[model samples]
Target chain A: MTGLMRRWLAHAIFALAAFATPLLLSGNRYFAFIAGITFFSVLWATGMNLLYGYTGLMPLMFGGIAGISAYVTIGLSANGWSFWLAMLVGSVAASLVGIVLGLPALRLRGFYFTLCSLVIQTVITLAFVYFVNLTNGDVGISHIPLPELPGGRQLAGTAYELVLATIAVIGVVVLTVIVESSFGRRLTAIREDDGLAETLGINVTRQKLAAFFVASLFASVGGALYAPYVGFISPRSFDVLLSLNIWVMVAFGGRGTIWGPVIGAVILAPVPFVLQDYYTIKDVVYGLLIIGVVVLLPGGIVGGVKRKGRADAPAAVAKQAAPVR
Target chain B: MSDTTLIILLSTITTGLMLGLIFSLVAVGVTIIYGSIWMPNAANGQFFLLAALFAWSTSVSWGLQPALAALLVIGSSVPLSYALEILLVRRFYDVPNRNISYFVLTLGITQILSGIFSITYGVWSDQFQLPPLVPGVTMLGPFPIANNRLAAMLIAAVLLAILFALLRFHRYGRALRAVFQNRDAAALRGVNVRGIYRMSFVLGNAVIFAGGVLFACAYSFDLTIAWTMAITAFAIMIIGGPGSVLGALVIGIVFGLTQAVASIFASPTIAAFAYLGAMLIILLFRPSGLFAR
Candidate 1:
């Protein structure tokens, strides 16, 4: 009955559904594959939420970071290393790169930082394509071998889906823990006003870099798993659009809320697959959705609902006090 | 110099001038909009592509002269930008942190435009080229340049000169610069801030459209040019200071020359890396840009 208990219960239910969906759709591999992909989206959106929601930085290079990990992981695995070890190294290396890329965020705020990140994303994609021998160029590496298990069995089918589900659930739990921690409070403070947070004794630069490292881990880990799961890896796979799509998920779900991005990922992830036949119109629909979220639902679905509940809040008070032009 | 070196040197110069002029045009367009409204138009590349595509359709498919088609495309951007300003852009002018919202909004526009292009133009042909506006080759020393490309380069240069003159001497230009310096202060000086916003949006987009049409005239293009040009234009804008037209011109030319010269020794992809590396360095050392005034 307590709020804490209720929150935990919600998470538990979410985990159960995540695990159950794969088993439920195991009879149809197509649907199960979609579920697995949705899990990746959930993990990605949650990572994005940490930076975008809590830290107020919308990194358009998120997918590029993921691609960095994916490429590194794939390259290392091809050279006679274990996939697990490769993934670990790839994630850390990508995270380090992410911190370097995020150095601009220390000085630039809001739109400038976003533009800088956009440039970084473009460079990352170009690197993926230019390094042909490593990434196999625009042709992309296909038939990527699946990760191996401890029992010498390949991780595939229902087991892979379960693992993905578990990862997604863990991602959500990790995000929730971070959100409730003192570090989360610092991030929130910085997001609200970095200058004010600095005046209040928050080390804005260090906190931001730490946040980048943690968030990049989320992106890179999912990316490392993504290559083998999809059985392919391409520069196109982790380009700006992917980053935008994940950002869209977070923004649409209600950034700054724990459950919002997960809900957004669940609803929006399978949309392209479901509308596969109408592929031409798919992007148009997404475009309209992005515009709609910006124009009509700036706070997003969850945030909009929360705002309505607090209709008499300070925002309204401030609006009332403004002089009529 | 040997014949091959002579050829490479001439080609680099010619290519650099043509590409540099076009890059300056587009970067100027982006800077005006960003300088005025603080809205970093992510879809500026899409706007550029739209102009190119429209020119291709009119000149090649509709049988209009290339010059006429270019004019039509540039003129058409006026109404298109007006509609967009009134419908979408005007709504965000007063919002705090409007730049981020505008960025996201234009990205939506980008998605729509790219998606539409993929279906319509993508199905038509993988590549598109407009017919030469003038037939013949212009010999400059040992290098034979296509008359059409030469003409495109001249027109781009003229446009840049005219743009510089307008911004430097014209009343509208002064007002625009005023708004760029301080929006609130500009308003205090009896300048209609909203009207200036609308004008700059339309003018900026019109310049971008001109860049696109001119690019089409100079070379054959595909849909992929949109993203490439977008990144290149942004790099120029960043290095040149967001609101400085002079900065855009200088940095744009430098970038174009760098790309042309680098491609001579290495792959074209390496040229991209070089400019991008330069932009990153500039961003790190001078976030305000090389020409911030």
Candidate 2:
């Protein structure tokens, strides 16, 4: 097929796949909502992948950023701002926090920065719980207004799925554009070797901060959208668990590739539903799966396959770029 | 001074010191493991709770003494932890993701352990006690020190001293330290890196076991206790730096005091937030921590 035809065909296929989801999961709002979250999680995971996978910055605080975004959005809406405006504000605030945290955090390498993210997550979780007047002190912020689409349609129930799907698609496109940009190349370079990148005239700090901003932007957007869709916002909803869940998706699908996290979400998101009957052991299963993946399959399913595919390729001609780089 | 105010002040300091010791125990476990393996295991707290449960259950059912129960639990924890290290932790060493993977792996374990414990133990309040190990409150003029708190403090000091001695003077500790400072160098020098790694994991759990036994005696335990202890201990470690045992001790004590002071002057809710706030400020200003090296 011609390149243009292939492109058009891919787009059509993607659209069909998106539309087919509701039809396949029909009548179960829970399933539909989960599917929506899976997509949103894919976005979140992709953001993380951009950091950890593409940029080699494995931040464990993605959930904190998301939680903060949700809280901020809910707080703004409670004060009578429009839902969209509030979400926008929340996203910006979260991204800014991300940049600020990243500035100091980027100085650390590998595990140290990850530790910093954990500390950030803990601190933020405590902030939510302690600020009872604002966060309702574990009662959580409830009954957040759902997004409003054109034609007076409220973005809740089935409509919420459509809204989520649309946003997810746009998010993927934006991520793809950013991934292919010169700025992304700089991040890749810094990820490969910060010292080398610095020597080569790349602003490593700027790139790391930018990557942090980008990652937090997606996470916050996901969180802001999530609150209204879930119709409630709780600090509990966004914890280390959620962050790990997102990380699992990213890691399971493959990292560095746009399609990997989406694929991961598809495979793993419905897992809890399938095992809903085994509620108690679900955590055990989840735990084993995370450990198994980390130990047995570091490359993830797709990543492993891709690595195998490239094994025989001539190293001299092949790209010398790091995965994160 | 009013009786109520004096009591409040006394309790705060006493509670702070008790909590600080518990925090130190757990933080030392986490730090030692990190020092050796480079993986910060979040499951330390969960393992702690489990160790406590084992101790409590055996003691209640079989009528074993509290000290004997603690010894039994700590003894079992070493082997169980060794098994875990071999089965789960060893594989992650070469994994490119490093600490985050370890973080998530242990987090998964945390969920599993907590869930299992809650299911088995019924997620209700379970408190343990010791029969006057130190006997009677000692009054130093106006300040009264409870025997329980005094005993806990003493036991903690002894355990910490032994741990330091082991790390500072013992052959095994030297092997462990050799493995910790640089694994490759240690391996080249004929230090059994894998053996040390397994031993470190076991020792880490033993420390946690000790902490858990003391913790149960000091406070109530449920499924949430692990997380509660985990967060506070985590704060202490972060504030003090990840690899410093002494830092963990000092920071744990300082955090405990700060938390106590906050609770006395403000609400308990605010106290918790203040602890977290202190951590954030430390991280913000001194991310290397107060004593990281």
RMSD of each predicted structure: 3.2, 3.2
Instruction: Tell me the tens digit of each residue's lDDT in model 2 across A172-256.
Output: 7677777778887787787778899999999887788888998999899999988887787777888877887888888888878
The DockQ of each candidate is 0.75, 0.52
Best by TM-score: 1
Off by over 4 Å in 2: A4-12, A24-26, A311-325, B1-6, B92-97, B124-149, B187-190, B268-271, B274-288
Deviating ranges (above 4 Å) for candidate 1: A1-3, A312-325, B2-4, B123-125
CA-lDDT, candidates in order = 0.92, 0.78
Candidate 1, residues B52-126: lDDT per residue as tens digits?
Answer: 999999998899988889999999999999999888999999999999999999999999999999988876447
lDDT, candidate 1, A185-232, per-residue tens: 899999989999999999999999999999999999999999999998
Q: What is the TM-score of chain A in candidate 1?
A: 0.95
**Best candidate (score: lDDT):** 1
At residue A187, candidate 2 shows an lDDT of 75
Following a full C-alpha superposition, what root-mean-square deviation does model 2 have from the true structure?
A: 3.2
TM-score, chain B, predicted structure 1: 0.97
Q: Residue B65: error of model 2 in Å? A: 2.0
